[model samples]
Target: MTVTTDRVHVYADEFDEVSRILARTTERVRLELIDGKLRSKAVPDGDHGRIIQWLLRICMQSRPELFLHPDQGLKVQAYRHGRARPDASLASNDAFVGQGEWADPGPVLMAVEVTSYDSDTDARDRVEKPRAYAETGIPVYLLIDRDTCEVTVYSEPDGVRYESARTVPFGKTVVLPGPVDIALETEQLKDWVH
Candidate 1:
């Protein structure tokens, strides 16, 4: 069950054990298996937390039938040895009505990521994740880039990357089309911190 990458090793079916071991530590870390590598990061900062909350609340109010899940690990069929834990997710209520820990991307409407301070974090949020999510057939990938002080909604997945994308600044409104069409108010996304 070992998935070997260039610089890291991950066990495909050992996520539960790994999570259990990591849970004993004081640091709040999230883990994902991608491209046969184990990727880990500390839970986002307070501002990121607040924004996720805002998005969740708004999504709930806009579409009551769709459930907003925050920081839940998604088990995707596209990647054999990967789990994607998006910042926030919009999915049908039936997707997890009687589910357990992990979620399948089949019923997922969109995935959201709030970029972090580090360059690697930013790259993953901006580049790697979007491509992977699209390849998995997730309809939308919403990226809130802290460094750029902007939001990008990537849609029209073609099994490689998004065919369409829209970017807007902090003070503008970003419209999410199709499945969960809603205009997001981004005036309060907050400025980038040095």
Candidate 2:
């Protein structure tokens, strides 16, 4: 998940609450877990950040109509289910209308999570997270793996799951839903690791 961002400020209470709950989760064996089941690498060493920043830049540049997002919470709450916040989410319309204590329906169009060193986190972001996103009916999901330096785009939901998708290497340019086209350089992205 993206942390330490610009524009949208994360409320400390929400952060603490989510974090406290995540501390008890057992599914996060040997992987980075933040705010209870919200799996993400702690802080990307160096290479990871570059890929993430580049994607962010590319998205904002192409889709001027969409909300430029950071690691902000969508703040969806049900009576018993609680709330979930993705690393970064893009909602097509004003889904956050008339939210008082917290947002409902969730602010989601596309959610992107850049994978860390851990393969499990990468898998979760690539698979389970996309499942959850599909369940919410979010249009697109993006997963960036800094280790292998690959980016995957998933779309076309089928029963709380993504059945149609495309996977692109950093060498190839991938065009997002909008006019945003970004080529993630796998070699350059892994430079810091070497």
Maximum-lDDT candidate: 1
* lDDT tens readout by residue for model 2, 59-87: 66656566645554444322223244455
Over the stretch 31-132, how does candidate 1's per-residue lDDT look in tens digits? 776555677765688888888888888898999888878877787535555677888889976676666556777888999998878647865787778877
What is the alpha-carbon lDDT of model 1 when measured against the actual structure? 0.78
Error of 2 at 124 (Å): 2.2
Question: What TM-score, computed on C-alpha atoms, does each candidate reach?
Answer: 0.87, 0.63
**Worst 10 contiguous positions by lDDT, candidate 1:** 1-10
Evaluated against the true structure, the overall lDDT of model 2 is 0.55
**lDDT, residue 93, model 1:** 68
Residue 158 accuracy (lDDT) in model 2: 69
